[model samples]
Target chain A: MNPAVPTWAGVAASAALVLLAVAVAWHGRLRLARDIAIAATRAGVQLAAVGAVLLLVFQHTGLVGASGWLALMVLVAGQVAARRARGLPRALPIATAAIAAGAAATLGALLALGVIAAQARVVIPVGGMVVSGAMQATALVLIRLRDEARTARPAIEARLSLGLPATDAFAPYLRTTLRTALIPAVDSTKTVGLISLPGAMTGLILAGVDPFTAIRYQIVVMYMLLAAAALASLTAGRLAEHALFDDAHRLRPLTTEPRRERV
Target chain B: MAPDELFALDQVTVRRGRAVLLDEVTCRLSAGVCTALMGPSGAGKSTLLRLLNRLEEPTAGQVRLHGRPLADGDVLALRRRVGLVGQQPVLLTDHVPDELRVGRPDLAEGQARTLLEQVGLPAAMLTRQTAGLSGGEAQRLCLARALAVGPEVLLLDEPTSALDAASAKAVEQTVRRLVAAGLTVILASHNIAQARRIADEVLVLRAGRPVAHGAAADIDYLKEES
Candidate 1:
């Protein structure tokens, strides 16, 4: 083999991806373009750092390092969820609780079923997918819950005065609000196969895996995602209810709290 | 016991965010009588009524219903007996009269229809979607809803503020009828004519405090302002 294709091919591919990202950024406003440029640079550096570490860790350390990688994924996921809901005072705890409950439960079930083995290579990627899905669900549910509580406060108070218990009085609105938040996950689940084959399934097939094996993996992943999304949304919804109401059952002003400014 | 002394407030004071929304606001609402609150904007007119219902907790005073202290244990029980209506009448997006009456399975279909008629709404409107009801019709529906709970004291908070002249007159007539039927009505409004026409007593609030409160006909200050 005259000269095996340069190991730098991976770097060259990433550089090309960066160029395309910059071109897209150029079409936006200057502020957005600057943000995009900074984000792309950060992402590239972080990925490269992880890639180097992974190369050494996988070669030397065994299963223990792999567990570290899985835990790292969860930590990153929690941070992203918190960042997304930074404006809400109750976001951090709600986000972490949601992501942890959702990812762990769904992932545990899948691993036990042998859909994904206990191997870190398989476990980490699937867990990352499930956790990220939960994070998005948590963010959406919290935003909707906060907004609906404010907009419909009068109605809630009216129901309360009608001799309905606080929770029962809020049940109608909570149902509507939670259902609205879950619509995205519901829609995605409904349109999954017909709209497009997901990346993991497509990639597995491209790598010479049998069609039936790819289909099995895709089905398992999709169901786990739905499971994760539902759990996260429900947990976030419950937390939001607590955060919005005081111990006396009076509504707390969601907008009154001073939010920390992003750096 | 006379219905005239149905509800009483003993030096109720409430603070909201460093502002004294109600200070030493003592008043009594009589059964089968219409009491109107008259004051300029930002006067504690609305806040005073909210206190009677225990919707807002008092900072340094107590509210008594039927001569008993209003406390956490009695709040829900009292609230069920008190019907409070606000300016913008809100109805849930779904549900017609039937759904609202589910808990009180004893509520007859005829009673629901009669409620609509009492509020001057067509019985046909009850079957219609709440989304399609006009401001006037919806206010009437809200009144009907409040009546469904069988309240003894009706707290009216600018109940006609969002209605047209015709709708306002309709709602006022409804209130008049309710008052005639032995319900204690506490009406909060800024309109002098409204107070004079229906109120046996008047309470004026200013700067989160009651500046003037007494019989409507005897208050010369209202004449000066109106």
Candidate 2:
């Protein structure tokens, strides 16, 4: 059975499976069947668009074009992360810089070490995985940091009024946010092959790669994700902490309203 | 400005959007005296107190500490000299001693014990978990934590409003003792009797404006105004 090319029949079968899940959701009165259907449809359309673009880049693009594609992905991911962190100041720039730095550093190290060749087919997909992981970490850190600043206002203010510096006052919250952001990456790495086959390994095996080679690549991907997530979350957390306080080291009133004006 | 004035609010006004939290308020707080701020809930008593320590900035006018603007020097140093005890006691750490040692990490155990005793808490309770303390005990612990920094002026916003009669009395006596020891204190309270008992002067607020300012015994206008 050739797994390289997927037919429309296979896609239809997948849609039927989704319908079965949606039916069960409706039966349970979860009220999420519609949401599931919408999300699944959106995912299909988005993935198909991305697949078309990647095929063009892989077939004809040089390094510059491949890099441009990667930058576009990072930009889109940053916008999504910033939207999730709507009330925070300078969320877009902060998320973009963090994600780009994390993905670039990890991918650069892999290439420099000669572990992966700098080909469009290899670099583009690996870069996408790294950027996506970092984007998720950045978004989680920003959201959690904003929440901690809001919910722990009294405690943070108490410390500040006691003459503690802003950094010292927000230390506990920063620690908690970073830990929470990094947990998913760490847990997925731990359970990668034992509980569930990860996407990279599964895709490579289905593409007729040797099992050993696929496993090795998956391990490298996992390690890169953990490093990238840590870097992105720490950077985003540090930048977001400044937005929580004013120049006087006082807790700035949490901006509850949506910030429509970009700085 | 008076010679002994420790804090002066000059034509201060604080507005949040269209809502005026504090109107034009000008007053002097003398050193080594407890000035009780008495007003209704929305009269901006807490907002007024916050301005003294720059917890909330004024939209107009200025706050002066010792003939200098409150925003002049290092804010952290200013906040250290002007300690604040919020209405609800919030401890950062589990142990009572650790709570007291938040900013003052070099605080000696004996000094911590003394602060606990000063606030009418048993010295032995310093080692106990803060979460295990009752409401009144926690309030007193917060007071001790404030005193741990050795602040010259203390701003308390309804510190005893949440405590029972006995605990309130204990806190009131502690404030009185501190005032006697030359600690300047500004306290906000809804309890007029409490104000009369511990305050040397009374400043009555009405809808973000100061309606009366005089000796504690002479502010009988509050009884009619409130």
Candidate 3:
């Protein structure tokens, strides 16, 4: 089923919304107008490129092409997450593993249960959602773990001096970061239908599907996102914890360590 | 090289970014002796104490504990034998008993009370929260927590600097008792008089360099300051 086509005029009209945002930022002296403009331009260009690629894959590729698309998305998502996880060693690899694990667990369960169709059109969109959610959770977990590890260095060292293993010494901070990382997912999920119509449900309804049917899909999406977030946050938090401490069970301060600062 | 040598820092050096916190300094701290690390603010007293417990690894050289390389054995076990009370009191848990049980979770109430008493805190302190403690009380609590693990060597980083005169004296007495009982102490202090009183040996550091290290009484600067 085809949705209403947007002409260039319509695209320009929609792009004008970014100017409004830029105007407000300029008025407030927020110094974000340039960033906002750049981000909007990048988003438009990237989405256009992704759309062209997806169309090509849909026409000429099978399950392999679809899987390749998902893998590519996972890698890109990992890089995005790693950008936010400054001062963490092996952040790129760790983020990739976490995002991959979360996405696999989420999509695997849905696929096994026959909840989502195995078509490329279905898998790519659902995988994108799962990977995006996982990326966000992973990045949040890493950032929180890094910041809390620095601030709580004294307490962590105190635990280490007590002869506690590195994992045991870092357990409290890991728990805190995990909880903090999962907060957004939990809050948004709880308030989904009440506060806002999430992207999936909006898309489904706009695709001429029944509202009640769209509601079913939205619930599944919410559940999958929750699962992805928990899995990703735990993986990233645990991995980052291991990175922060040495074999001597002593804390190596994240910022102080001679690491390549992501500037 | 003596059989009684507890911690031997063979040219141990620590650098943070562009600053050299501890220069090439070789010193052997004997077992069952109280060794004070005396220095000015940035003279690396804390850095030296941390080295003994293997808290901060040196940028260069080696640290040998009990005649073995510090990295030879399990670090957790090493830390248990060599405990550390940092400059500030950072009790793991809010309550006294729980804080004591942080590393040793199987700690009994009686044992907790005994550790408290050993640190000059009353047994009644077991019921108190760490949040309400005074500077001296908190430092003593940190000491009690360290003692709870039954460490052979205790590292104290300015353990009494934050306390008032009376509280400092109380901590000093506790240290004397521990030393008499054959516990090794590597203390970091700015107070020269305090060092002379408590330390059997003193290693004077000036700008991270070892200026002098000998028996506390024989150290001319320490004697002169006294």
Lowest summed lDDT window (length 10), candidate 3 chain A: A254-263
**Model 3, position A40: C-alpha lDDT score:** 98
Which lDDT tens digits does candidate 3 get at residues A38-155?
Answer: 9999999998998999998888896679999999999999998887877787789999999999999999999999999988888999999999999999988987787877789889
- Residues A1-263, candidate 2, lDDT per residue (tens digit)? 35575687788678988898899999999998998999899999999998898888888886777899899989999998888888777889989988998888899999999988899989998999999999999999988887788889889888888888889999999998999999999999999999999999999988889889899999999999999999999889888887777888877776566555343
Better of 2 and 3 by DockQ: 3
Residue pair clashes in candidate 2: none
Error of 2 at B162 (Å): 2.0
In order, what lDDT does every prediction score?
0.76, 0.89, 0.88
For the record, the alpha-carbon RMSD of candidate 1 to the native fold, in angstroms, is 3.6
Per-residue alpha-carbon lDDT of model 3 for B1-226, expressed as tens digits? Answer: 7988988888888998899999998888999999998889999998888887788889999999878998787888888999999887787788988988887889999899888888888999888988998888888888888988889999999988778998889889999989998899989998988997899999999999999999998888687665
Candidate 3, residue A78: CA error in Å? Answer: 1.8
What local lDDT score does residue B131 receive in model 2, on the 0 to 100 scale?
A: 87
Relative to the true structure, candidate 1 reaches a TM of: 0.87
lDDT minimum window of 10 residues, candidate 1 chain A: A1-10
lDDT of 1 at A50: 81
Segments of candidate 1 deviating more than 4 angstroms: A1-6, A20-36, A52-89, A206-208, A247-249, A257-263, B1-4, B93-106
lDDT string, candidate 1, B106-171, tens digits: 778889888888788888776788887778888888888878888888888898889998888888
